[model samples]
Target: MAYKSLLTLASSAEGVAAAVDAAARVALASDAHLDALALGVDRSQIGYSYVGSGAVILQIAMERAEEEARLNGKALKDALAAQGPDLRFSLDSAVAQLGALTDLVSSRARYADLVVLPKPYGKGSGPEAEAVIEAAMFEGQAPVLVVPERGFAAGAAPRRVVLAWNQSREALVAARRALPFLKAAEQVVITIVDPPAHGPERSDPGGMLCQLLVRHGVKAEVAVLARTLPRISDVLARQCQDLDADLLVMGAYGHSRFREAILGGATRNMLESAQVPLFLAH
Candidate 1:
């Protein structure tokens, strides 16, 4: 199904316009409406451990956080207004005050068709931000399009799309969810990595995926990449770059949380070091 509403979460006013522009582009292409959610983070609540951790301290912290949220909200609203009158914008703030990062995202995932989240800034491990992304993938039920923090302009329609296929349930779901963008793309590539030793019959799901896309009226090509490299994320990133792909479509492959940490192999690697816009669905 085509996306009807796009919900993008913004933390700062810096990339707010770009985020809205990207959302508006998608809305225009899919005939959808763009809804923007600007998140205000209370830095004081950064290490807040419990609800009853000194009421006076908590109240002061929450107040500062709310003020920061308001400033961010006003900046975003003003930016959108400057862009033009055609774009529809909605402003709201949430107290990410309680629970883990995942809990916050899960709570917000209920309201939108899709979520657009910005990559965390700086070079340190973005475990918290990554948690937010993971929560959206597992709990949101809808697709999450992650925007890179630097380089590349936002709101540009993807001209080339790549599907990272492993023939898993999550991968198949991601493929199906990417149909709208895939159909509109000028070129589509289905990349399979480290296939089983047997063959296409019992080995290659990517071949089957390519066939499926053809049936769906997508002009797609299948290619296999050797996984000799240490990380699959590196391999996939290189493949996308070599193919000159603007967007990458991949299944959000991961086992249940208790079984493993930070999703699974591919999901973890890609989320941590994603180079292009990725459309992930579980």
Candidate 2:
């Protein structure tokens, strides 16, 4: 399905430009309505985390944080204007406690066809960024697209795309969610990292998936790679560059909520180091 409504989460002040750029890029490509959300923490409610117990210190910190949030909102509007002219877009802001940002983003994302988030930075990233990522993936019940720190100017639309295919429920879900992009892409490579040892072996690893997409007017070719590298994610990342792929679509893997909040070997690795934009769903 095509993304008729796109929502982008700007977790921090520094991420506004990247978020706007990504949202606008997709909206322009698919003629979708774009909604950019800038999340702000109520400094008074969250001051204790930054400042000690003193009331006066907390008040000062809260004031500074609030002011910064205001400036961030203004900057986001300016960026949107500069980048998304002639595109249908809206700017919104939300203020909540640091602990509740995830729920807010997830709830808002429910009405959206796709949720775009800035990639988590190495440092200086608040909990809101991480929470938004987790909520969008697990709670939004929608496709989550993570734009790298470099920003999403990959192409007009994801012309060269790679779908990481495995015979798992998660993979199927991811593929279905990314159908619009696959159908629109000039080239689609269904890359299967490694085949399973057991189960009835199919003549082609990614053949069934290719056929499925072909039924929907997507011409996808299969590419199989042996698990010779130390990390499958690393190999996948390299393959993206090798193929000059602009987007990488894959399923997110996480176990039970009690065991691990977000735990997936390849998912984690790609989340941390993927240079290309990623379209993921759980």
Candidate 3:
């Protein structure tokens, strides 16, 4: 299956360019329609008690934020127009109520084939961005394409890709959802790190997953590495670099979110450490 419809959310002017570039690239690659929603914070939903003069300042700040959001939306439209001459794309703005931003984004993403989002930057690592990611991966029930904060290319989809396989339900789902990308990629390496000794479905390491992908017209090779590092994410990152992979496809949040939050897991570590594009699903 191919990605026919894609969705993305832009939260700030600073990240609008990158977000549009990444989204447009994917849309162009898949010959899909892109729908980008620019986000603005609604001050009325804020819980701060406004004092006499403080209320005026807060109102002004919120107005500025709203205006910035509008400008960012326009920039997105212009960028999409320029980058996607043969691609279908649209841009609009959405005011995110304080507590309902995640819900709004999640509900909107449910209608999309894939969701593209910008990775967190220095000061951009706020609740809003985190919520958008959480909403897309868990609540949206769609594959999430995360672009890095810096140096995002708007021209082409990744040619070389690495698939981190673990024989888990989430990993299988992620691989299947990423079939389009895998089939299009020039090279696909199914990297399995420290596979379990035995699982319910027993077979040669990575062979079963590889055969499933082959049936989909994706020719992939399996690379099994012994678990020698402290964090599997680090190994995956190194493998991506060694293979010169432009994209990494893997499962997200295989374990409970709360558990990953407290103890850390491959999904969390990769989300934070990966510099290349990531195609992730729950």
Candidate 4:
């Protein structure tokens, strides 16, 4: 399916502009609409808690949250307006009461073809910032494109892409989700590490995946990292750095709710820390 709308969640004007440029690249390539969403904190419902000492602290926090959100919104609006009428922009704020940040983002994801998140602010120790990132990762249904904290300059498009393939449904879905970007990329590399010893032997899954990409006319290559001294995540990160890859696409490995005992090894590792922006599908 073609990606027609790209949504970017921004907290700062610079971030908003960067997101717009990133989304616009894809939109320009595929003739899609670039939607820039400015995320702000909601303060209306912040003081609803009834616990001791909680009420007073909550009230003070609510005022501070509201002020920050308003400030961020104004900054973002001004920045986008300065860019003139070429970009489409929207302002949105969410009140973090009873841990509803995830629900708020998930609701927004339903309308977006893709979602972009800026890395957390401050020392990255803020609870709200952490919640926002987690919500985007686990609850947001659409493919989320993350921009680093330092941010990106305008027209900084992804040239090289790394696909973390593991021959799972999530991985396949992630690849498909990234088809638009992949088609526009200068280079695409499919990397897989620590293949299970018992999977199909005669039919090499990695080979088949590469063949499929070639069939689609994508400039693609395949590399299988021998599980050596380094851990799988480290291996993938090192390979990505070596390839100078700007983006990483991979399946989000996880188990079904019913099968608590079953889990994906690679997925767990990638979640701990990823060196590049990962396009993950579950």
Q: What are the lDDT figures for the candidates, one per model?
A: 0.70, 0.78, 0.79, 0.64
Listed in order, each prediction's TM-score against the native is 0.84, 0.87, 0.88, 0.78
Q: Write the per-residue lDDT of candidate 1 for residues 1-282, one digit (tens) a residue.
A: 677777766555554554555666676667666666555554454355666666777678778657756766776676557656665556676656534546667767756677776654335323445566667777767788876654233444687888987767888898998888887778888888787777654555577778888888888888888996887777889988898888888887656654446345776667667778788888
Q: Among all windows of ten consecutive residues in candidate 4, which has the lowest summed lDDT?
A: 256-265
Note the residue pairs that clash in candidate 1: none
TM-score of 3: 0.88
Pick out the ten consecutive residues of candidate 3 with the lowest summed lDDT: 42-51
Q: Indicate whether candidate 1 or candidate 3 has the larger lDDT.
A: 3
- Top-lDDT structure, candidate number: 3
Distance from true location, Cα of 18 in model 3, Å: 2.9
The prediction achieving the highest TM-score against the true structure is 3
What does the lDDT read for residue 203 in candidate 1? 56
The per-prediction CA RMSD against the true structure, in angstroms, equals 3.4, 3.1, 2.8, 4.4
Q: Residue 33 deviation, candidate 2, in Å?
A: 1.2
Q: Worst ten-residue run, lDDT, model 2? A: 254-263
- On residues 137-206, what C-alpha lDDT tens digit does candidate 3 reach at each position? 7888889888876634334667788999987888988998898889987878999988777864346788
* TM-score of candidate 1 versus the correct structure, residues matched by position: 0.84
